[model samples]
Target: MLKQTLQQKLLQKLSPQQIQFIKLLQVPTVSLDTRIKEELEENPALEDGSLANMNEPIEDYPDKDPDEQFNSEESSFDEEFSVDEYIQEDDYKDYGGNYNGDDDEERKEIPIAIQDSFFEKLQNQLDLLALSDKNYLIGQQIIGSLDDDGYLRRPIPSLVDDLSFSQNTFVEESEVEDMLKVIQEFDPPGIGARDLQECLLIQLKKKDQENPTIVLATRVVEDYLEEFTKKHYDKIEKQLGVNSEELKDIINEILKLNPKPGDSGAVAGKQLHVIPDFHISNNDGVLHLTLNGRNAPELRVSKSYQEMFEHYEKVEKSDKKMKEAVQFVKQKLDSAKWFIDAIKQRQQTLLKTMNAIMEYQYEYFLTGDDRVLKPMILKDIADRIDMDISTVSRVANSKYVQTEFGTFLLKSFFSEAIQTDSGEEVSNKEVKKILEECIANEDKRKPLADEKLTEILKDKGYSIARRTVAKYREAMNIPVARLRKEL
Candidate 1:
C-alpha cells in the first residue's frame, strides 16, 4: 500500500565532508601522496602550487580586523561557505593547464613492471635440461600446472588427459610423473610434489649428508610424518623402537626444516612499501602519540580563486556576467574549503580514537610485550571515544602505528576476553601467548594434547574448554597432538 506519512525520528548521518575526512584519516603516509595526486586530478579548484609563488602577498585586498581573523562563527558547522559564489568560470577555464611548473611532475604515475613467476623460473631451468622436444614440452606443461606453493595440486591422470586433449598429442601418466620427479628435484626441491609427505620427503632427500639432523629429519618425514604431526610419540616410538631421548632429538631435527620453502623468497619480489599511520614514542613516563603528519597535506583554496572571489565582491557595478562569475567562484571555493576542512577533521578524529586506544593499552605500548595487552575490543574503544563500534573498527583496520618496539597494525592490540576459572577476564591474546610458551617449552616426545593443554591452562588459572584450546591452537597454526608429535 502506498502511504504518505510525516515521520519524526532523530537519526544521525555523516555529511559528505565528514565521510571524506574519515577515509583520509585512515590512510598512512605512503599512500597520502597518491591520494593527493588523485584529489588534484579530480578537483580542478585544487592544485599543487609552487612554494615560492604561495608565499607572495596578495595586493588590493579589503582589510578586516585582526581579532576577527579566527572568529567562532568561522569555525561553526552552521556557517555555509558556498563555493558557488566564490569561483569564476574564467578562472577554472585556464586552471587545467600545466600550472605547477613541471608537466611531468604534475602527472603522478606509479612504476609497475611485470616480473617472472615461480613457474617461469622452473621453465627456464627446464630449457637448460638436456631432453627431447616432446619431453621438454611435457616438462614445461607440468611446471605450468604447479601451484604458487610449489605443489602439483592436479593429479597425474588428470594432467595426462589435459595434455592429450589440450596439446593434441598422446601423453602417458608415466611421462608426466617422470617429469614431475625431475621438477621436484629443481632448486626448491619440493616444487612439484603432490602432497605434504612428498613435499617434505623431496626437501629431505636433497639435504647435505654431513648434517645428521637433516638425515634424521628426512627419516622422520619419510617414515613417521603422520605420527609425528599428530604428536603420537608413543605410537611412533613403538613403531620405530625408539626411546624418549631419541624421539626428542629427531623431533628437534624435524623442527629445523622449512615447511614452506618457497615462501621465504616470495616477499622480496612482491612486498608493498608500508608507511606507518601513527607514531608512538615514550616521553619520560608518558607514552606520546602522533598521527603521521604527511597523511594530511596542507590543502587550501587556490590563492588565484580567492583573489577572483575578492575582486568580484569589491566591484560596485552588478551585472549578469559578474553574478554568474561570482556564483562559479563561490562554488569552487566552497568545495575546496570543504575538502581542506574535512582533512583537518579527519586528523582530529584519528588522533582522538588512537589516543583513547593508547591510554587503554598503556602498559602494552610502554613495554613492547603482548602479555601486557589488556582485554580490549572495538566496543571498548567506541564507548570511550563516544563513537560507534563500526567507526572504531574502521579506524583500527589497515592502520599501523610505529612504536619503540616495532611498527604494529593497530588491530593487533584488540582481543576478545575469555573468562578464567577464578572469574577474572583475560584476553585471548594472553591465552595464545601461554599456549605458544607451553609448546615452546614442552617435551617434544610427549607434546600436550588439546585436553592436556586445557588441563595445563586450567592449572595456570584459565578455565577454558578443550574446544576453545583447539580453536586457539588452530589459530596459531599448531597441528593436532598427533601431528605435533616427534620421532
Candidate 2:
C-alpha cells in the first residue's frame, strides 16, 4: 500500500524568532532582568554593558561583491577553518570598557537570587535524625512521600511494596512504623503521619502540659473525626459526653493547631516579595497605566560585535577560511539582531494588550469596585487588541496589576457571564460578592442553607441553582449551615 504523492498547502506558523518574541511578551517586568541575563550568558554575540553607542540605530550591513568571495562548494581541502579571529574580544572589552577599576569604584550592586524549597528543609531535619543508616534511609523515604501540605497520604503497605520493588530492599511494616514515630517528632510535629487524626495527635503529644482542651481535641480527632467533619454535633455530644460550650472550646483548640505542620517554616522559607507588574492610577477622569520599570534593564546587541561584523564584510573572497569566518559572524549577528528586535516587539505587544484591557474594564479600575467589573474573557480581550485568544491568555497568566483598591492577578478580572432573572448579564464574581455580603450579615446561630441561599439570590434577581450556590460557597471556603452554627 505504499504510495508517493506531491501535496501543497498554505499554513500560518511561527518562526523560532517569533515564538521567542511571544514568550518574552508574557514575561513581566519582575522577571525581565533575569531573562536578559540568561540570554546574555547563552549568546556570546550579546553582551551586558552600558555603551553610549548601543542607543544608535541598526542599519543593514551591505553584502560583499560575489566576485571577491570564495566559492566554498568548489574547494577540495578538508582542513578546519576558524571564524573566531573575525570576532575580536577587544571590541567587546572596548564597549564594556576596561572599567574593572571604575566598576569597583561605582560598585554596581547585583541583587542576590534567593532560592529555598520545602524538600530542602525536610532533608535538613532528616540529616539530624540519629538513626541507623538503613533506618535513616527509610526516614528520608517517608519524608520524601509527604505532600506540599506535609501530610503523608500514602499507606504503609503501599510504601513497603514500592521500596521492595524499586530499591530492591525489603522493609517490614513494623520498621516503617518505628521510623515514622521518630519523624513525627521533627520540628513540624505533624509530619510523617498517615491520617489527620495521627497528624493532630503527634503535634498535641509534643506540648509540655496536657491541657484539657488539647486532650479533648485529640479525642475528637482520634475517635470522632467522621462526626466532626460531617458537623454532627448531636452525635459528637452524645459520644464525648460534653456540653456545647466545652465542645466549642475543644474545636477551637484543634483549629489553632497546624493541620499541615511541614508548611510552617517551609512556607516562609520560599516566600517571595510581591512585585506588581502593572500600576494603575487615576488622573482627573482618565485612567493612567505604567508598567513597573525597576526590574527590566535596557538591553541591546554589543556594539563591538556589530563593528566586528562590519570589518569581516570588507575582507577578500579568495581566502576560503576568511569566507567561512564571515558566514559564522553573519549567523551570530543575525541571531543577536533577532533577539533585540524580539524584545522590542514583546514590550509593544504587552503594552498594547494591557492598555486595551484597562480601557475595556475602565469602570472597575476607576471605581475600585468588584461590582463595576464586567463579564470579560480572553476572547473579549483578543478581539479588542486584534490578537488571538491564546495570546491574550498568555499575557494574563502569571501577571499582576496594582490598583488603588489592592494588588490582583491580571486574570482575576475575567469571569464568565451569568444571566439575571431580569435578563441582565452579570459576572459570577459579582454574584459571589453578593453571596459573601449576605453571609457576612447573616445571623450565625441559624446560618442559611444552600437551598435557602439559592432562594435568597433568586429574590435578589440572580437566578442560580442550589448546587451552583454550594459550589460558589465552597470556592469561597465557606462551610455549610450546620458547620457555620455557633453556640
Best by TM-score: 2
lDDT of 1 by residue, 1-487 (tens): 9999998997344443444555565555565566667667666677665332466432222211111123345443444433343233212222122212123355464565566666667777888999987788788788778777777788888888877889866788888878877888886667778788888887777778688767766777888887777576787778767778877887776676666655643443564555688899998879989888665565656878888889999986369888998877776777676666656656666788889999999988889887778899998988887776766777788678999989888889899998877788878999999999998888865788888889999899998889999999999999876655444
Taking the tens digit of each residue's C-alpha lDDT, what string does model 2 give over 156-244?
A: 99878878877777899999888887777777678877777888888878764468878878888888988887778778888989998
TM-score of each: 0.72, 0.77
Global lDDT of each model? Answer: 0.72, 0.74
Estimate the lDDT of model 1.
0.72
